[model samples]
Target: MMKNNISYIDKVRENILDHLKTYQHSETIYNASKYSIEAGGKGLRPLLLFTALEALDTDIEKGISAASAIEMIHTYSLIHDDLPAMDNDDLRRGKPTNHIVFGEAAAILAGDNLLNESFNVIAKDKNLSAEVRIKLVETISNRSGQSGMISGQMLDIEAENRKTSLEELESIHAYKTGALIKAPVLSACIIAQAAPEISERLEKFSEVIGVLFQIKDDILDLEGNPELTGKNTGSDAKKGKVTYISELGLNGAKEALAKKVSEANSILNSLDELISTAGLRKIVQMFAERDQ
Candidate 1:
């Protein structure tokens, strides 16, 4: 059964990749965007989007476009994040950074292209209700806008090489990392037109997963291999950025990570829903043990 779910997810990824191939209207930007998407991550956001939708008994067709849109937004962020102005990274997902291969200018354009196309992907989907699509788009804009992911990035940049309080650090991650992680769960809720009470529960559940994702990431960066993890490690320490490990200490951060994962599972178990939560449980375990 788990193997079936994994195959299902792989098929979804192939669908996503195939759909990306159709965006060839602009030769350069299209190629660049495709390149970034092809240079894979775990495809966690889209998986979460669909998985949550399934768990909520939402129509998967109506949610697939939104899932693709979420993946696009994530890819765009990665391109910009590896830019010379940001992390200045030379490698991503075990390949040369987008900017490095395409040149910084084209990579920037590619990121912008993905960001805009994300909206188009959602808007053009005829399966989802216009109202739900509108809400999804609005949510994406707000979550990715100045008040959300971008704000977190700005705060993180400001916090670099400085002593930051635990509260401040959490604020940075909640916006920067948590917003995207939360986006899919929220997107699923929107597709389902779930009651406010149910959406609120999933929101809290996703929040725990999002921060745990980052906390585990911080631990991995400190302890993971550049070869296996697909990029340089020790970047946090090198950049003098404060992370969960920095704020809570290694053992302390591990404790916190475990606690959050436990909390997320408790919420998932408590949710009023049907269909197997086996997929989500597997994803959580992956995050907890991911090498990359």
Candidate 2:
């Protein structure tokens, strides 16, 4: 199942890249956007989107545009996050960041271009109905906009250099990291036209995994290999940013991760009678045990 999931992820990455190539008429903007989009991070958002569709017994191809759009937004966030005004990181996915390779101005434009183009891609998708497209746009916008990821980012920046309570840290990440993560899964639910009961269960599952993803990331930042993670470990600590590991201690954080993982699996188990949850179960394990 893991190998199959990897195969699906590869297919999704290729589809997104092919879709992105349609905007290659420009020189600098196109190159900068392509560079970051093609960077070597795992296409987790798209994969989750596809996997959710599979779990719902929907054709994964039905979600191609949405998956691409979400990835573009995610890549845009990373590009802006690495800028001097933000995290100021020099490396991303084991290579020079967009700003480092393309200069700050071009990189900023590249991020902007991706953000704008993401909406266009969804709005113009001919495969989905007008109503579905509109819902997709609305969902992505709400999740990635101020009410979701961006608000979380602001909270994170504010909390830096200070001790944050566990509740505060979770709330911050529930937006920063968890929002985008939830976007893909929720997008999948929308695409599948999942029944209300099933959608509610999956939403709950997404929420658990969203927090689980962050907890695992916090653990990785402290103990992961830079070669595999494609960025500096311990950089969070160096930046004096609060994290799950900081608030809960290393073992405490791991315990929280285990609890979330179990919760996620239980949610999936509940859905087993309604849908084939094999793929989602694999995703839970991947989130819990990924090295990077």
Candidate 3:
């Protein structure tokens, strides 16, 4: 099963690269964009989309374009996030950040290019129905737009250097990180045309896992090995950013992470009778225990 999952991820990467080939009209912009996209991150969002599709008993192939689109948006966010004006990191995925290699201006444009092309990819996909494609575009835009990820980002920027309550931290991540995490799963449901009840349950499951993701990230930032994570540890604390570890303490954050993992498993159990939960259950475990 793990090997199959890896193969699926490879397919997603290949599809993303194939789509990027068409955008090479400008060499600099293309290289900047491709450099970040090819960076060796886990590609979790697209993996979640594929997992959800598999559980829905839909052909994962049908989700390839949508998966690539989600990954492009994710890569774009990382490029912008690593800029001097933002998180300002020197390394990402074990190499120099896009802005460090490409000029800041080019990196910014690369991010913009990826963001714009993501919607076009969905809109022009021939495999999905017009209605499905429209819905995918709408869902992605809303989740990654002002009311979702961007709003969360604004909240995070505002909270910096200030003591944030648990509620405030959760609210910030729910928008910034959780919103995009939810997007891919919801996109899968839309593509699968699953039953309304099933989709609703999966939506709740996605919410739990989204928070789980951020909590684990907080722990990893503090405790993970830089060699494995491909980024410096303690950068969050250096930035005075409020994370689960900072707010709840290290042990407290681990406890919270454990509870979320349990909640995710319970949700998967509820869906066992309706669809194959094996893949999603593995994903939940991966989210809970990943070192990078």
Candidate 4:
């Protein structure tokens, strides 16, 4: 189930990459854009959008547009995240980070380009109604902007080396991580014209899974092999960042992860009408159980 789920996700990512390649040009700006996009990751946000849209059996074309847009935004975030002022890591997904390949200025512009130009892809898509396009614009803007991932990053920077309550921690992550994570799922439902009740249930699933995603990430930081996780593992401890594992202890974080997995699976079970996508459910379960 896990292997097939990963293959399905890879196919979705390849489709998104094909769409992205259409926008590619020979310009240096285009080269920088390609660099970051090609940098490998799981493409989780876009996969979530695809899965949610499939669950509704909606317009597949519009769903592809939404998924591709989310990937652009996510790649933009990664480009900026590796800049000198941010994490300053020289490696990402087993390649030299974006800023290292492109000069710092080009890297910055590449990220900026991806962030701003993603809207054009959605707006120009013929499949979506104007109202859906507008709603997607609003949601993606909010999710990627000041009150969402950006704000969470700012809070993360401010709270570093300072004591933060568990509530404060969740607030930061909910915005920084959860906002983008939830956006793809919610945006897909909107594009699919799914009922409000179904959207809310999926949003709940996104919330819990997003939190556990980061929790497992923290655990992997402490215990994962660098080869498997594709990044240095000890940096979190070296940076003195407060993570679920750091705050709650390793065993405690594991217990919390188990509870989240159980709840998330329960939600999936409630949506059993789309039981054919059980591979996605199994993928979520693997996310909960992975060591790296």
Ranked by lDDT, the better of candidates 2 and 4 is 2
Residue range 1-292, candidate 2, lDDT tens digits: 4465556666655765676687677788888998987785888888898889888888887888898888889999999999999999998999999999999999999999989889888887899999999999999999999999999999999999987788999999999999899898899989899999999999889889999999999999999998899888898999888999889999999999999988999998898899889989888999999999
Arrange candidates by lDDT, descending. Answer: 3, 2, 1, 4
On the 0 to 100 scale, the lDDT of residue 1 in model 1 is 40
Find the number of clashing residue pairs for candidate 4: 0
Q: Flag regions of model 1 displaced more than 4 Å.
A: 1-23, 272-276
**Ranking according to TM-score, highest score first:** 3, 2, 1, 4
Candidate 4 RMSD to the real structure: 2.5
lDDT of 4 by residue, 154-243 (tens): 888787787888888889888888899889888987898777877788889888888888889888888988777767887777766778
Off by over 4 Å in 4: 1-26, 273-280
lDDT of 4 at 105: 92
| TM-score for each predicted model, relative to the true structure | 0.93, 0.96, 0.98, 0.90
Look at candidate 2 and give me any clashing residue pairs.
Answer: none
Superposed Cα deviation of residue 7, candidate 3 (Å): 1.3
lDDT of 3 at 246: 88
Candidate 3, 195-281: lDDT as tens digits: 998999999999999999999999999989998999999999999898998899999999999999999999888988998999898
- Candidate 3 residue runs with Cα over 4 Å from true position: none
Model 3's TM-score against the true structure = 0.98
- Candidate 2's TM-score reads 0.96
lDDT of 2 at 90: 92
Clashing residue pairs for model 1: none
Better of 2 and 3 by TM-score: 3
